[model samples]
Target: MIMDLSKQVKIALDYIQSIDVSDIDDTSEAGRIFYEKFIPMAGEEETIYKIENLEVPSFEQTINIRIYRPSNEKELPVVIYFHGGWFNAGGLESHDRPLRKLANLSGAIIISVDYRLAPEYPFPTGLNDCYNALEWIILHAKMLGIDLKRLAIAGDSAGAALATVITRRAIQNNLNKILCQLLVYPVTDASLKTPSWQEFKDGPVLNYEGAVQAWNLYLPNIKEIENPDASPLYSDELSDMPSTLMIIAEYDPLRDEAILYAEKLQKSGVAVKQLLYKGMVHGFFQMGGIIDDGNRAIEETAQFLIQNFNK
Candidate 1:
């Protein structure tokens, strides 16, 4: 059944329709517009206890990372986050507001990793950057005032896909400090053939054609789409994945894949919690200023992280 769009979301979609985004994929035009327009109106930035910028050395390159300390508490848990842009557009600045809110709400030091984008740095580059950042954070936990034992990984959309893949890699490498994964409407499959993808093919925020474009831009070869590292849903084993909390939107093309991933995790013996927000569409989590559900999801996400941290 098709769900009606929330009133606020409908208004937001109208505003989006008014813009001339026909050239969104041209020279990162979509990113420019996102930073200039959408970001400023994303809502008030949360008051963080402290914020720090650092560069982590990773495979002959240095990846930028933003750390948000929520309080003066020592040995606090940490959440390493990756921003979503279908692995091409978003960065540290584009997602600053939501990360700050997450830091404050979760009361955990939030390390936002600015992984390299695709089309230029295609498949494996961004993923490797994220994994390297995770390793660096764990290695420098003591100096960063982070409790290695209570570490968590999180991201929205493409970033969530990275988080899941990172968790799996961590398990394989036996770097088992990760306690949980907080995925917000993640892109779990590169195939883009799910029922929700067809149902919401032209949905407000993300559409089927856009998703296909994203995958094509991120993966040089179509075969990469089935690679587990590129698509978490294709992973052979998920039994040792970290405890998970996935937030799904009813009207999102990525909805079914996210739900299916949660079910797969549960069957693999991983503790899983899934929340389906009715009448919501993709990217709602980043629209706290315009959508009430964004803030509520943040609270719920924080609670979930806290519960896992305490365990």
Candidate 2:
């Protein structure tokens, strides 16, 4: 058995190592291949509310949204989620377990959005779909029994980047419906100059090269890659963003980016809290049962959401 760490942390690290490491380095076609194989290994859990996929009328695209509601009849706050796959992979199937746990832990309605992937739909497509889904949820809030004033946006990895962008777009558009953001190791910068990138150049799960590959697929163009909407770290206006809780891994490549974003948010007068889990790597929160840190991260996030939301 793996030792030299806490019981939970060991399990999490083992889970990370147990994943097939062969194709992980191949960023071209192998990235997709790894994800196709990785999702099934993620495991599952039963959710409290029924899930349904819906399409966006504006884009004429079929966007998958999994809605989780409590057993009570009252309208709860809505948490819109985007799953992580470096913007190229991950969907409803890969993230179902964590969303379910989040919904139950926070006692809120969870709406998980399967935004369009990269290299095909690219940049604005996925970001716009997420924002559009938020709009749809607000327009039909009454139907979904949702509290418009208490809505929040959340995501991991590339999804987290999308969440921050959506929050910025919402704020800029005068949509004051967002209450807070739960960002789990978000990729804020695309310049790849951050120290975290160099330190975790060979880190597990989300390696340094994988980061570049994902960005290449999403942006595909040199100019568009540096756009603030595509890379939140490039944005000049961090003000007007809602209260945020950013969870970072001590040993992950995106750690500095997440920290820098938190610093920017704080400088902008946005209430922000940063939680750093030591000796942890990327992709810990979503890998339930396999990692103790995953469970701990989920509980901490749920508590944070319950406290700041609707206040």
Candidate 3:
């Protein structure tokens, strides 16, 4: 272990060691299942009043979305959530508990977006699904009883990358309603050459080689690696972007990039708050089943949105 991980994470890693999915390609069926095993814990389901699945139309295909409403209050603020899976794995089900807890804690309706994965759908497809889903939500806000004027975008890891891209796209469209972001240990850069990436080269959870593989699977065109839409860290216009709450894990391979992005956001005069979890590794934010910090990340991150949304 590169860092002193939490006891909970230590035990969780021990269980991970017992699994045979390590050698499997992450985009493979068994590999995706391996990612989910880390966070086997469920949330306080009673806290959420409703969980419904719906679909959104995009140019390429129809994407699924799971809505989590803690209450039936009229015109509630909402958080559009994208699940983390390196743009290959992860889905609405894997991230359900964290979204539910955030919805309950923030008193905001949380919508989990089921954007398409990579190695099949690839770049722009998933991004398009997420961006179009946001547009759909904005257009149908009244019917859904959500306050379109108060909206936030959130995601972890690869999904977080999509969330940032979506927010940037929303800004370009002059959509000021999308005003806040909750990025949990996001993949801000596609270069995958940050110092932390090298530091955690062996990974307690995510490693540099694994990240490279994910990027390879995601971006079909190598020339687009530095494109702003493909990698938000390369985007020059950050001044008018949404106020952000960046969640970071100290031992994560992507740690330095998150910090760099936070610095960029601050330098651009955007409102930014960073919540760093010491003694933690990558993907810990959604591991509530094994570690208390997973839920703590949700609880702590909820207030940022609540305050931003004025809920």
* Candidate 1: tens digits of C-alpha lDDT, residues 1-311: 55677788886676656666666777566654653466644689878899999999988979899999999999999999988888888888878898898888889999999998888889899999999999998888899999988989999999999999998899899986679999999988898888988888887688887777788889979878889999999887898888899999988889999999999899899999999998888888877888889888888999998888887
For 55-127, candidate 3 gives per-residue lDDT tens digits of: 8888856889898988889999889998998898889878877777888899889999888888888898899
TM-score of each: 0.95, 0.90, 0.95
Tell me the TM-score of model 3. 0.95
Q: Relative to the true structure, how large is the alpha-carbon lDDT of every model?
A: 0.87, 0.80, 0.85
Which has the higher TM-score value, candidate number 1 or candidate number 2? 1
Worst 10 contiguous positions by lDDT, candidate 3: 38-47
Report the lDDT tens digits of candidate 2 across residue range 142-181. Answer: 9888887788899998899999999889888987668899
Residue pairs of candidate 2 with colliding backbone atoms: none
> RMSD for each model, in Å, please?
1.7, 3.1, 1.9
Name the candidate that leads on TM-score.
1
